[model samples]
Target chain A: MATLKVLVTGEDHAQGPEDADVTLVEYGDYECPHCGRAYPIVKQVQKHFGKRLRFVFRNFPLSEMHPHAEAAAEVAEFAGAQGKFWEMHDRLFENQERLGEALFLDLDKELKLSATAMRQALAQKTFEARVRADFTGGVRSGVNGTPTFFINGQRHNGSFDFDALVSAIQQVMITAKSA
Target chain B: MAQSGASKVTPIHSDRILPAGAGAPNFTLHATPDQTLTLSDLLGRPVILAFYPADWSPVCGDQMALYNEILPEFQKFGAELLGVSVDGAWCHAAFAESRHLHFPLLADFEPKGAVAQQYGAYRDADGFCDRALFVIDKKGIIAWSYCSPVAVNPGADGILEALEDLPK
Candidate 1:
């Protein structure tokens, strides 16, 4: 169906080493229910693999479908500029049901980010371009829906449950080792 | 999966679609109760023909939903995206509204699957169109075609790539 347009690159918001053996990229929407469910599972995936895995997240908000999706993605990208993207990412998914201006303001205090700066960023729409770039990349990459995961450079056509993801990653790990 | 109440008809669209570089067959289909669209009317612009089995089938739902999301990309290439199925105009209207789709879904009803049969995408046994795609260039020639498994979503990557390759 959809193929990854550009592979994991220096511009991505990534966790783990730059040269990790396995690179897992998730094209996600914070306001999407399925992505919220995937949040904890992705955390477990990272914990299980540790140093062997590199995880990257890209914004892919379906703005027309989810009214709050674009705003949530803007907040995440703004937090990324302040060096707390992962924290904001987790908080957004964890507090998915309450995504709005007030929640973002509250998160600014909780995450020790600058409230004035966050407010201005949202008001001025500073990171809209950044979020849109990620979204455009996701669209080109064959991301048909929220929480579409790419293992290596290939699209994973199976389910994203724990066992399915783990086995898929292990298969990649094996392929890498043999090569 | 085949939709419930679909008739058991003989398979006629089992053959592959018209190959790339071939002249695309022409047909007109109803896009809405009051609107009709013809292949010839879309000659100057690129056309993405998305042929799915039925309106409400699960995989077709996902496929169309995804298309609804990236419609701007198709428009960016000066392309017309049309969803084709044997489902009637009323069924398409309901489905498009429920999904908030922004594109025209042509009804290949009346003589069901007539257009799909011209493109070799009709499935006689299933009594619906197969999940297929064809990207036609400005000259009304087939630029790309793909027949995906009936159960899969068949995302827009191939369609986008084909559109990108068309002459400016």
Candidate 2:
């Protein structure tokens, strides 16, 4: 089994308590259709687990296959720089169907981010390196595709649906508690 | 399900693929509708030949797309990656275009798996190329080769490891 090569650090975008029983790391692309489908399921999982689960997301954009993925990641990173990472992250997936310069600009307005700064950031690719670091980290961690999950540092090979993910996390929670 | 005695005695053909240290087989295959790529022509630089089953089917877990994403990593090793299948040039052209692939996807379609047969990567029963990967050195010698189960996508880690092991 492939284990996570890069551990979660202060640089990571995380939610929930740091002392949570389980940590779920997802290497996801913003424009991947499968990841789009998984978006709500993950939300459901997060809701189901609540304070017991910690979630982290990393960018693993397949730029060739999904043209807007890298830019979307950059946008999220830009939002992250301004402390609105989760809001931008959720909005990107929530509006995955219309991902482009126009959609990004609209998101900037809706999220109340600076239009000028966002435009300059996108034009200059200011957040590209940050997005690329996450991508490269995913690659080294045996991530060949988007929405790859690593539960508690071990790669999750099972389905990403609600029931499957819940059961997998439950099993991990049990093991963690026992240990 | 219980197997019959006849089925138990049936011999499976595990044809040996060209192993490491063997001289790589030279073949010219259609990289596009008009252009042909020969294995020997890329003698000075390392080459990676990936023989997958088909074009449209995600049987190999979108292996071509995975390779397409990591083309830069392969480039860092100064290696050229080529995807081969029995699909026609037109089909490959469409697939490559749709996937935005940077590497050339050679078509072994004219004679139908002729190059794959030479490399022992052809699936005789299925009428398509098996999911196989071959890393050839700068001197046209097989440095490493792997044949994964048809349902599995043998990721690029092995290829990268092999490239790292090659003489610099």
Q: In terms of TM-score, which candidate is strongest?
A: 1
| Candidate 2, residue B31: lDDT | 92
Candidate 1: which pairs clash?
A2-A142, A3-A141, B11-B124
What is chain B's TM-score across the candidates, in the order shown? 0.90, 0.90
| CAPRI class of candidate 2 | acceptable
The TM-score values for the models, in the order shown, are: 0.91, 0.88
lDDT measured at residue A32 in model 2 versus the true structure, 0 to 100: 91
Q: Please provide, for model 2 over B26-72, each residue's C-alpha lDDT reduced to its tens digit, 9 standing for 90 to 100.
A: 99999999999989999999999999999988644378998888888
Give the least accurate 10-residue stretch of model 1 chain B, judged by summed lDDT. B1-10
DockQ of 1: 0.30
Accuracy of chain B in candidate 2 (TM-score): 0.90
Q: How many clashing residue pairs appear in each of the predictions shown?
A: 3, 0
